[model samples]
Target: MGAVSKEPTRFTVEANASGAARYALGDRADFADVERGLIARFDEIKNERGETVLDASTFSFIRQGEDAPAGVDASLWRQSQLVIQLGLYKVVDHLFQVRGNGANLTIVDAPEGLVVIDCMEGVEMAAQAMRLFREHVNDKPVVAVIYTHTHFDHYGGVKAVVDEADVESGEVALVGPGTVESFNKYALGENVIVGNAMSRRASYTFEALIPHGVSGAVTQGIGPGGGSHFTTTYIAPNDSITATGETRTFGGWEFEFLYAPDTEAPEEMHIWIPAINAVTCAENANHTMHNIQTLRGARTRDARNFARYLDETLVRWGDRVEVHFGPHTWPVWGNANVVAFLESQRDLYKYMHDQTLRLANQGYHPIEIAEMVQLPDAIGKKWFNRYYHGSLHHNVRAVFAKELGTWDGDPASIWPLPPAENARRYVSLLGRDAILAEGTRAISEGDYRWAVQILHHLVFADPADAQAKELQADAYEQLGYQQEAPQWRGIFLTAAQELREGAATEGGLNTASSETILAMPMDQLFDFAAIHVVGERAADVDLRIGIVVNDTDERWTAWVRDGVMNARPQESQNVQATITGPKQAVVAVLLDPSRAGDLVSSGVLTIDGDESVLASYGSVLEDFDPHFNLVTP
Candidate 1:
């Protein structure tokens, strides 16, 4: 999925923001040397494509205001200020980091060469970061690249940093944990549904849809928001770190891995460089409170596991660490400071996990628990511990929902009316005028939440209702202004913009790139095909087809029976005729209609199966609309 264009809108700062900004500025951000190192290390850095990656223009918003503007929280604005401080920074002797270049890329100087830890989201960005590292830090070549997790932000820009030819020639090693499996599952499996939804929601989370200005996109709280204008590609890992304490020496630099799976990411690991006395927390511990459940939907992250891993990291190496850093944001240094940082982060996730369950067992609904749960004064009061990315309220609800499914013991909610029907009934009963009056009162009383809640009925009841839409947009703007979390602010602001103007006109998702689709393992491709099969259309059809990948010497049989699609390795020859082709060609036939004629003409794909069966299979494949409306039904 990609970004949608939005016109910049102007908003005025509220009275409360003034005090909040003063308080935020006064907070002791004890990393003076780190801030100094983020000064302009280079004028500009570009990728092979001549794309500007690390430049001043993208983050020009840093100089836009001296204080928090309207429709933005002051604490968040303070975080944004730190977040936008981009440049190559030296943590210790030979340990350097490229921050604010998409995602932070760490450079470890090894005996033979530099070992890059976690490439960023795009080639352009990662390449530029490396360029800065080379010119200012070291000119040594990258002998190895370590991906801490499965997230694209951590590993997508491999080609920019190191030559694939080097990796192919066994000169440079590509290392990660659960790299291939996690990438295939998350990036390709039902991506048409999941990826599209994520892209849309992520636009809000990263604030990619909004322009950067006084009243527009500000900060992602982790780093500057980055969802647009980046080329993404995947590189498979040749070396896997299977277990915790797995020690590996890259170019004679010894490093130990902490196999921290299912913390912030599904497959994540932390690296300890005993030589430098620093631990790379990967995304497990970032500057801000990370999502137990990100706004962009996925399997809810394990809060308990997340907390325990941090605790374990401290127990294993807390005393030895002098500095700690991650894929995003600056590093925290000093043995005492680093330990405190780790402890605070550990308690942050654990507190939410423990307290959420405590509240849930007391017969409280998820929504009720969200409101009731609050971070302790120690954790909540700290500037670093504040919810800039992850909100305590939403995370508490996520914990409740994770344990108990969405079904509360209430029967009325089990079969609630769809939005439009429900809204019509609500408007009829409450009366449209009455609802509007109440919404207006709520707005007057500075209760933007109530105004948004009640006015939503009027707008949905009658989508063409101009007055309701206007009022709702106004309320959303106010709510957006009040929010401390960047995602909440961006989401509310985007909704307000959509209401005032209309949904974005541009941006489309390229769900499967040629490289990613072609590189996908045959089993994974078949598994993905099974997911995209339209069950309703295949309810009456019982069909089996064999896919023979000549290039990979693999054959898989897939059957759509009783409205379910099942696939497995071809065990016996007792099947319908086989469609033989190269792996990529067969995948293209299934997914990319644009490539059909080319593949057929080139004789890369040929089917011996009944032509009707192939046609039927094609007909049952579902194509999702990427630009589905989020604010509206």
Candidate 2:
């Protein structure tokens, strides 16, 4: 036969059922908490053009009280049922939240007006969420906006709720963790260097192209499936919480911030509202086990730091925190329950960190360590600590990588052949017929992981081999069906889709915004330009350029030599060219040198000396192809 069928195989069905049995699926307390305090529900949320931004009805296929279909993990299906509860909920006497929009938009009643925490992922979603809040809850003016972290979902919708003029005029305070420079550096510059590669990978991680149904995406672990497509906007923060125990009174509410860096994000903080006995741990603590290293890719989070922050939160405010909410998932009520929740989450990460290091000390490789470590039942059995977002398998590997780097101490394995060449050699050595037979047999034996690995070489060796592609896709689908973590599920399923169909034609999540780019500091902007320079193209190019920003009164010297670009503050003697202009015009010409003539002619830029230097440098800059291939060579 060509391959196993597209439908969930008997092996997949049994695997999913067995996984579901491990959880207390019949316990309906989580369901009660999800539906509690619902003030009103939106029929659906849409953008200006009437395109749907979010529609809970789309997930109606997931029956509330029924067992999960074979295509989805049973535990995940139950979580999705709770996630699809879309509405404005009253968290307490003064706090309200808008859910089912990827990130939670919380509104807190302050003395002057409303204090908003987080603004969803984009303009439309935040706008719709704010509209619902105004319609159902209090319609007070928003006096302050607080961003819990640097992630887009936490603060990208800034413009939807607050005006830039107001922030500039000091009419509203925009508060964030760390200094303004640090926030801007991470928020705007973190991904600009390797954005294209990360974006393409994110398509698989978030199931960006997967349809919402029983057989497709169900949830993104923290919330419903399908990433947003609205306009993502940003505004720089006016006030910074630089240290833990930093206090800022926004509209009469005493907000205590815990500056948590390098946890879920590079710059993040948790909010403790003392007057209300409520705390929002930002994205640090959530309903599910959060990513120690996100599937899409980022610097590995310090699991020790993650556990430390949770423990600190518990020690500082465990007795006083009556209710706990976050940017994602439902809140935990009751001080005792909240404390217990924090302890479990804290222990979960601590165990992962300690155990992984223990095994590493015993001379185990990351792969071997991943297979060895297991969560103890005391914390592992809790619903909050379940592997809905992050799993023990990948997380243990992340901890290993964090401590011991990528190398496994084998010099022979260190310098390996490129993927395509290696795959070709493997196929040639094994023989195509033997590899295919083994793959099929592995699939028949419910060894989808092994099947994918063996068949992957065949597909990579010969991209047009339809038989290999189909067999690999079948294996991936079975693996996808059995994943409890949605990120793993998304990756496996999207891989299967790519194998069966082809690489995605369009790009994935793009975080670069005009506001963000413009806000980039001069040094960072030059750093961004350096990464864009192609080494081979710039090898023969030699130029020293001087730059002056009139508005910012900044001076810099940049030069290209020996296939690399370098820059420093202050002007250099004997520079070939000096370009003087406002920061915007200078940035535009630097990004796209073809616009130099128009800008100079329009009096936006003043070019002195050899004008051709700009052209010479620009020629070496390369624009990234967003839709790069992933599964295939």
Candidate with best lDDT: 2
Tens digit of per-residue lDDT, candidate 2, span 576-622: 99999999998887778889999989988999999999989889998
Q: What is the lDDT of candidate 2?
A: 0.85
lDDT per residue as tens, model 1, 1-633: 113332222322443455384454665464454485562454455555666544556567665346665556777777777777678887788788887654888889987888999888877778778777767666887889998887777776788898887887878988887656664565445333366677777766667666665466677788775444567777777787878999988878998999988778777889999998999888778778888888877778888888898989999999899989878888888899889888898898889988988977888778888888888778877766777778888888887777788776468878999998999999999999999999999877777788899999998888889889888888887777667888888898888877877677665334345566566677777666677777898898787878788988998887788778787887447556567788878887666434655776788877674656766677777776656776666
**lDDT per prediction?**
0.75, 0.85
TM-score of every model versus the real structure:
0.92, 0.96
TM-score (C-alpha, index-matched) for candidate 2: 0.96
Candidate 1: residue 342 Cα off by (Å): 0.5
lDDT of 2 at 531: 85
